[model samples]
Target: MDTEAHVTERDRSSDPDTREGEGSRSARFLDAPWRRPALLGTACAAFLLLFSTFVMQPFLIPSGSMEPTLRVGDRVLVNKLAYRFDSVPQRGDVVVFDGTGSFVREEPAGNPVTGLVRWAAAAVGLAEPAETDYIKRVVGVGGDRVVCCDKRGRVEVNGRAVDETYLYPGDVPSRVPFDIVVPQGTLWVMGDHRSHSRDSRDHLGEPGGGMVPVGKVVGRADWIGWPVGRWSSLERPDAFGRVTAPGPVGSHG
Candidate 1:
């Protein structure tokens, strides 16, 4: 009788339903209220990271290079898809590009943690731009003759004057004299604050002659997204009005 009683107890404990009930209770504990929010927060963070890295990213103004148009500390939205569909950047468009082999001294560096934080900040439109990133106006597109001080000290593109009224007050179109015809699939960019900026003109003696390859261009700056009082849509300057469309590679004034 004792043996039979012991066996009956053991069988009851070994039942599949009994085991399943304990598993269900364990699962409920593991999925407590806090777990949901934690998981959700993680998912949200990952989505934002992906979006900022691969899609549109917000960049903050860190220097006076693009001043008057983009002030220090102002945030701007960089449209990554703008160039993905289109093959070239247009005149008067503000562009951001990787300065790896083109302009900046060196490629930017960041560890995993720092990168994550920066990405989060940029996603929220608060972080400053990366060190190796550059923002400038496209003065000459592929196959355009961009010469400085065209008799009246104005930059000329395809034999037409570019009215740079948006340039910083007291800033000339270019203080450094340069005369170069942009090659096909390349761009010549300059800053509005010509005196304060180190643009393509700065690297005229360097490799590639300060010209940014079309492949390196990131996107156009379409709007200023932060600092509500300074918010405004970026308009294409009407300065290129009389400029002719790009013709043969070497044909220009």
Candidate 2:
């Protein structure tokens, strides 16, 4: 009788339904009310982080340089892959790029924690972009001759005048006249709000001769994504259509 009783107890312990009940109690301990929401929040954050890093990134306009097109406090979507696959920036395209060693002679250094905080803020358009990032419109590409204020008071590309209807009202193409032949694999960029912009014109005497390298380009601004009322797709202006391919090096326009 004692042996039979012990066997019965052991069989009950080994039964599948009994084991399942024990497992259910263990799962119940972890199924707290807060767990689901916390898990969901974590998942959403990770998705947004990935999306921002690899796909389209949102950049906040911090200056009036691109006025009449991109206003201060506006959020623009930068297409990071625009030039990644053997493509290059075209004239009249608005682009974002890291300016270290080009637009900026020195790269700023900061503490890790502060950098992290600023990065977080900039990622969501709450803070201005870092000192290294700049936005401007391409005016001349490699081999192009860019001359400011032709006989008609307009900027010229390869000896052709550009009708810049997009310029800020009453703003001239450039107050300071300039003539430059863009070197190969670089670009000459400028701002629509010429008076307020410190672009290639301002860095003419610096190294690289005010030309932004093609490799340093971050992406093209494809759209204004925030401030719903101001949202619109960015298109290349037709003013550049009349410009011809750049002449050979040393050829005067």
> Candidate 2 on 1-253: residue-level lDDT in tens?
5656444346766889999998898788669788889999989877866776667789999889999988998999988889987999999999999898889988888999999888867766678889999999999999999998888899999999999988999999999999999999999999999999999999989998889999999899999999999889999999899999977776772
lDDT of each: 0.83, 0.90
lDDT of 2 at 171: 94
Error of 1 at 151 (Å): 2.2
Residue-level lDDT of model 1, residues 140-178, one tens digit each, is 987788888788899988778788998999999988888
The number of the candidate with the highest lDDT is 2
Provide the TM-score for each candidate, comma-separated: 0.85, 0.87
The regions of model 1 sitting more than 4 angstroms off are 1-31, 108-116, 246-253
Number of clashes found in candidate 2: 0
- True-structure lDDT of candidate 2: 0.90
Where does the lowest 10-residue lDDT sum fall in candidate 1?
1-10
